[model samples]
Target: MAHNALPRPSSLPGIEDLRRGYTPSTHEARQSIEERSKQLRLEQERIDAELDRHIAEMQRLSLRRRDVVRELDLNHALLAPVHRLFPELLSEVFIHAVQDPFNVQKTDFAVRVLCGVCTTWRAAARATPLLWTFIDLSYITSLEDPLLRLQLQLSGQLPLTVTAKVQDQAMQLLLVAFFDGMSDEDASRVVEITVEDDGVVLSQLRSRHLATLRVADVNIWDTCTQGELGFLTSAPTLHKLTIGVQYECEDDDAALAFPVPVIPDLPCLTHLILAIENEFPVSAFLPAISQLAPVLRVLKMSSFEVSAWEETKPTVTCEMHVLHSLELQHYTHRFLTFITAPALHAVTLIGDDAQLGKEDPTESLLDLLTRSRPPLRSFALHDPMQGSASALSGCIDLMEGLQRLNIEDNERGVTSSPRLAAVLQRLVCDENTPPMLPELRSLSVQCRGDKSPCVHSDVAAPLSQVRLSRKDPRVCAGRAVAALE
Candidate 1:
């Protein structure tokens, strides 16, 4: 199409006279001004029309560009490798993407996100029963809420790991109803139960198929009767049991005087963890340990204290023939003197300076190792107050078959530099004297406290000597030094 030229107002005959301020005194001059003005208005209108056409064309091209981009993106997504994966493989990917399915705070978040992605993903997520097996009752607001029932239905007949945080009487009643409403098959499918409740809920709930049970904040005085804890004895398949007791009484002595609930003999039990908030009398649980020693493979005791009266009493040693791993936290040397593990391979002792009392922990440990003489492979000591350089050296000298050693010194004013330096120096091989822990494959030493400039210098030489002499490709060294502010 041919276009008309736009009028140049400056080229108009009378326009220059108007710019020079020439007054139109005559009728012809005034008429000429009016004619010029009329022409200029017509040119402005044409320019505005041309701009509107350009804007419309730009809008149309922008819409076309948007459409093309959308098509390109869609085609790229269709050609992606993940889209070609089968539904089963896609579901597996979704499963791995979900982190900590049993966590109450993030319960069902991953599954809900997967279901919202697309129709195909929603179908795959719904078809995978393992994705819905974690039943966290803490998120359920009411018994009438269909979320719980939906999870149960979606999980199908798979083994469910249930976590319940029943804090009030209403939640307790709800928990009771939840168990009572379950079918026999559903009840049998619950293999693991972690409940943060008082003893009442656990007393009533029983499952023969239960393999693991963790009860937190259990009030020993509430469930004093044997009948209340009879459910524990009924689960023949139970292998792991963790009990955490927290006493809120003002008189800790009085609380300690109360009788501890006698744990029924668990024939199949292999792992037992007891965490007490206050310093509990060891006498209360000593007999129970003696009873469970034969079948127990892993035993962990925390915050245990031997009463002054009990300290005067004779130490009754309990022999554990099959126990392999033992961890003690905030414990005294007297407690270690009472047990002997012949098959122990791993020993982890975590305590502060106050827990060491007057007794040397190294001596007690040496006694245990000498008495039992098990093939100890791994040993970890965390901030023992009495762990002097000489004392630690004496203990490490006995572990000839040790493979892994971890020492963490977090004592406030005490640094593990001296102890670690001495231990590493002993490990260095000499022509005359053989190296201690010749089979050691892993060494981790962490020292946290006010340290001197020479702390690292003191430990570095010995550490380098041991590392180079050991020359084993599998030897791994982890050294951490932190200054306390």
Candidate 2:
């Protein structure tokens, strides 16, 4: 009964048996790992340095590539036709780029965009006075904005068309300052101006420089202490003037007479339009119109408040000799009796719902026409009330010179088609009472309620007969009916 035993291992072994027999204690293996980790970290550091060198080289090459592209672009630009164009040609192009100088809301985009292109372009655009002449001060953010001064200086001796809208008190003061600071020479350069503000801006520009003024949407009577509208009387050169005022008073007692002292004689004022939105005493505004009658070529008054006025016998008859066009809207018959236009060629009368059945202006209108004996050619009556149609028909009876007649009854809430039809049917050639407006060639009829062809047929039949009896085929253009309805 004998047993066999195995041999014990040694701490170290020869290279031949090392791979199979060698094994380290726990501490010895940890120490060996530490040494290997340190060597690997050092090797990683070396590799990182090489990577840094490559990255730096790539960055340097990228900068050099950009420089080369920039130079190529510059060379290409030099050869371009636009770059070779003379400054004069560039100035002409800049002038052509400006769009809609009359639009008060638009900014000066043309000059700004052209000047921003390059230093050379900026000099060329700035030197062109025509480009800066249409300076819109509406978009100016502050008084300190250099745009106003720059534009004024760049414009040099050329005339300017200035348009601005003031939204606040600060802007109004700024506008006043802009005009107040303008030298006499610079102020004289302002030929045309359109301002929409609270009347202060215009009062500052009372220098005798402005020629044409269109003051729109101005709040006057309520804002001004004296309710003065004589803002333009100082402009001796003013030829064309348009004034629109809004009365924001809550009650009639709050209403004040506009232009308290009354508008002075504008000796040179030829074209005048005064549009009042709310009710004002005719006595207050009529004097202004009467004063301008002598020199006025065209007169238009629109949107007056309806009120009864005491009629006093006028000592002197105001006559307008050069007046070619007269248009009155929302006014009473008594108001028309004030002034007479002898040379009137065109008359447009419009009455609203408020003017319905208030007063008969036809007698005065007929009397005025008889007295003036104007060569009235065009007449338009829009939205006339009930009794107004028959009374105005008398106008046709008196006016044998009328060439064009337009009758529109849609907005007045009343229809006078039947009465108008009767008047048209009565048009006949007779020795005692000749056909009304024998020279009438064009007739325009418009009705909103019943625009059916049958409604206008009664009037159309006689118009065709008149044209036929006269043996004038050229009386109308395309159709026997002047308008569809």
Candidate 1's residue-wise lDDT over 1-485, tens digit each?
23677555658675687799978799997898798889999999999999999999999999999999999998998888878899999978877766454544445664567787678888888898887777777777766778877778889888877777777787777766776676667766777766655555666755344443432223332333333345556566677877765533345644555445567767888888887654555555677678888899988878644333343222667888999998876644445667888888998887655555444556668778767788899999875445567767877877878888887765556534666777778877654565577677788766665663223557778877776666643322432111111
Judged by TM-score, which candidate is best?
Answer: 1
Q: Give me the overall lDDT of model 1.
A: 0.68
Candidate 1 Cα outliers beyond 4 Å, as residue runs = 1-84, 99-106, 141-144, 206-229, 249-257, 304-315, 332-334, 353-360, 384-386, 412-416, 449-455, 472-485
Tens-place lDDT digits, model 2, residues 1-485: 22465554655324544667866558978698688879989999999999999999999999999999999998887787877789999888777667455533323464557777788888888888887777676766555678877777788888877666676777777667666666667666776766666644455544444444423223343343332344455567667777666645344534433442245556777877777665554455666677777788887777664743344546677777888887777654455676677788888777665655554445567878877778888888765435545677777777777788887654333333565566556653443443566666677766545434233455566656554554543223222322211
The residue pairs that clash in candidate 2, if any, are none
**Model 1 lDDT, residue 460, Cα:** 75
Best by lDDT: 1
- The ten-residue window of minimal lDDT in model 2 covers 476-485
The models' CA-based lDDT, in order, is 0.68, 0.63
Least accurate 10 contiguous residues by lDDT in model 1? 476-485
Candidate 1 TM-score versus the reference: 0.70
The alpha-carbon lDDT assigned to residue 474 of candidate 2 equals: 27
